[model samples]
Target: MNRFEYADNKFSEIEMMIAIPSFIIGVGILSLPQALASATTAMDGVFSILIAGGIVTFITWAIAKFAASFPDTTFISYASLIVSKPVAILLTFLFAIVFFSITAYQVRKIADISKQYLFDQTPVEVISLTFFLVIIYAVSGSRVGIIRLNMMFFPFILFIAIIVVIFNLNWFKFSNFLPVFQSNINDYLTGVNKSLFSFGGFGILWFYMAYVNKPNKAPKMAALGTGFPIALYALIFLACIGVYGESVTASMLYPTVELAKMVEIPGGILERFESIFFVIWIMAIFNTTAMAFDITVLAINLVFHHIPKIKIIFLLSPLIYAIAMYPQNLIEVSAFETFLNYAVFYYSIFVLVLLFVVAKIRGVKPSE
Candidate 1:
């Protein structure tokens, strides 16, 4: 691909497939096992994980098909058709807030995790500011460039994750998962709600689906993209419990990183395996942060057609950093996450459902 092609388009289904999981496997997975572990009994979290994954995967497919119905159309263009221009613009602005909030949440969470595992001396404010600046730089360029970065970084992230799970095999204790299917309705429901939020980023397809060249191919590819992260999450969740019983997994802040610390190579050449893991892990989180912020900028640019993307980046940079640093402590950060998750979780379902309902009411359907 030449520079023009790279800059102007990435309408391939394959690219969309790669982009979904690359964006979804950010800071959420680090704390997933801990969150799930706390919500259920032995091995019961798997049910929630699978149930939530299935739900997200199906919705991803439905959403892609919805967007693919209107070929070569941007989200706002079709939204304006279904709803009036004013309502669509208002929805776009609201979406900008949601994606911007995602950027802030990822920044803050990554900063907090890095302080605990990678940078003890560094202040979280410094870490968050630096991370957001890097994201700002990435978003300043082409959107295709951000997708290309995901393609490059995804392999290392997946490789490191698989290695971590594999090496921790010896620590696996089947007894840890023995008391299966014992949880009550309420326990399973709580786990389902949390896991559903963990699988949140597939909503990116609402915008990106408009880019797929082969509309017919998008729904399946979207489903495949979401499936990869679901499988990864389940494997890591099981591995964490197997290594540390549910009690221990729930007690720690980041059980996945703790799992990394237990990994040792044959030669002991690099004593700190987690340090390497940390480096690769940042790449994954960067993919998530960069994409969310880039889309935020894109949404704003869509509304303010006169303003260049660079200016939008500069304008939103401070606001992003301010939100990231607003959480004074981990408790506050958790509170912020809970708020953002619900906002994202319900907002995603709401948009898709609203589109479907209004479309049906008005007798609008996907073009053949």
Candidate 2:
């Protein structure tokens, strides 16, 4: 069986950053602020954002260091070259499971949110199935096609989100953020721990670095990608806090959407502004799900030495949908969130350590 080949030289660093970060920013933008506010006091949520951003930035730098050293190898291949084959395969399987589970959890969250906010009477299975179909279609496309699709959709999503932010500015109360850092320091630390899950998708860069047309520029592009999401997340977190006092923000399930509901245009043409926000959010979610599907397809092709056929993509969809169905309630989903927090923390640390050890073993010098 022939291994699937990426079009040997396609994506520029800027394109890679655009595709990768658009995938990471989805649920994080909408849900993380509320989670942070609940874990810490609203004032401390800002501090938590700084901490989360620092941790992610440092870890991303380490991953880029490793990618720069190898230049033209995927993480799967690098694992074997650095470690023994057995260990490499074991690690790859572990990461595959992690990616699959994360994908399922995100899909499930999208389904639940859609049911509650957008389609109040729609069945969860139907909603999930519909999105699952879309993801399969996305994954079946060529790599360039997926990249083009992401670039096209991301700008519109950002524009709508910015409009939502502006329209809702009047609802913000500066007093809501007055008692910054008044909460217990432990709460702020815990909030940072929780927010790590929001930074999960950036690691996709580890796999894509191998395919980056300009390997020399990968590190800078990776940094830009990582920094962009962190900045966007911080602003969104502050917006949530400003609109909803820490107490109320902490209590709401989807505080960002709730804040959008509070948006009122001066002209009073529409009563519900949240629907507009939701449209953009749906696009964001699509980008994320497509990214996960893309990575999974790439990994499968590498492992099995065959291009992913359309049938394989179709077959995988129902499996993902099934796994997504297991989270029976919000509590179960919260458990998954907790699991994701620790998983990302440890994964980041392991990848950094492994990268350093590999670089020393390989005797790789830093790139100019």
Candidate 3:
């Protein structure tokens, strides 16, 4: 089999739009509401959502524009073509480490949440390892297979998640959303800045655009991908804020899960709706972990001429597992998330700067 057999020029522009955002938005959606609540009051959460989503949308467009400037060349390839080989290699390494670390962190969070809420008796290591294995298997398939897998799972997850939200509508208190505009404008801006981390996955399009059949329209497709998540996240954020007071939502680690707990079907067929929600969430998290792992693998393959003899998935899995196992408690996990925000912020800067330098040196004009 070819080393990168999945790297086909087969995906339509709409699929590109769907697959890219679906991959990025999965895990991020779970924590975004709490992140906003902590940063500002419940009412201000709306503004935060809008500002963060808007900023992420702009950045996605910029990256898409950069990618489209060089048709048929991946970001790894174009970095070398535009900049010094050494610098390109350095950037590629940075990209790899970023994605790898993100994969580790997300896996760790999933394991932690599962142990806390679902399987109290099962060892955390076992739970996490099993989850990681499933992701590796999914990612090892062809790109088309992965895309189809995402299409199959995304709607079900969304449906379950929305049902949970809708069921909790009666619990929503307008009083919970009182004192609108009570928070300072600066507080809302800071919330927006922090919330940007929730949208970090949109950057994956940088690598994906090269393989798209209609490379010329990749920017528009990418924008569509970015928009989908923004809309979905904003709705969820509003729901969480509307249902629970700002203080209560801010205090909770995963407000979405809390929202799930509040869900009540008329028949009471399920006493614990959160458990059912967890099943769907596991699939969503698996999709994200697989996408992150696949992108990292592709970047490495592009940078190095020699494909290593070892199974790339097997080799990387243990390293990611080890990283996931590092955080001993939720405090440590929160610290790591803070570090991730800074890391992603710098990485975004790196992309923008790298593209600017490349365009200046290559005399490439901005896309028309």
Query: What number of clashing residue pairs does each candidate have, in the order they appear?
Result: 0, 0, 0
Candidate 2, residues 204-310, lDDT tens digits: the string is 77677787788778777776777767777777778888888888887888877887788887889987888888887888888887777777667666666665456
Q: Indicate which candidate wins on TM-score.
A: 1
Model 3's lDDT to the true fold?
0.78
| Stretches > 4 Å off in candidate 3 | 1-9, 308-310, 364-368
User: How many backbone clashes can be found in candidate 1?
Assistant: 0
- Lowest lDDT sum, 10 consecutive residues, model 1, at 1-10
| Best model per lDDT | 1
lDDT of each: 0.88, 0.75, 0.78
Q: Which has the higher lDDT value, candidate number 2 or candidate number 3?
A: 3
Check candidate 1 and list the clashing pairs. Answer: none
Better of 1 and 3 by lDDT: 1
- Residue-level lDDT of model 1, residues 199-222, one tens digit each, is 887778878877777878988998
Worst 10 residues of 3 by lDDT: 1-10
How does candidate 2 fare on TM-score? Answer: 0.91
- How many steric clashes does model 3 contain? 0
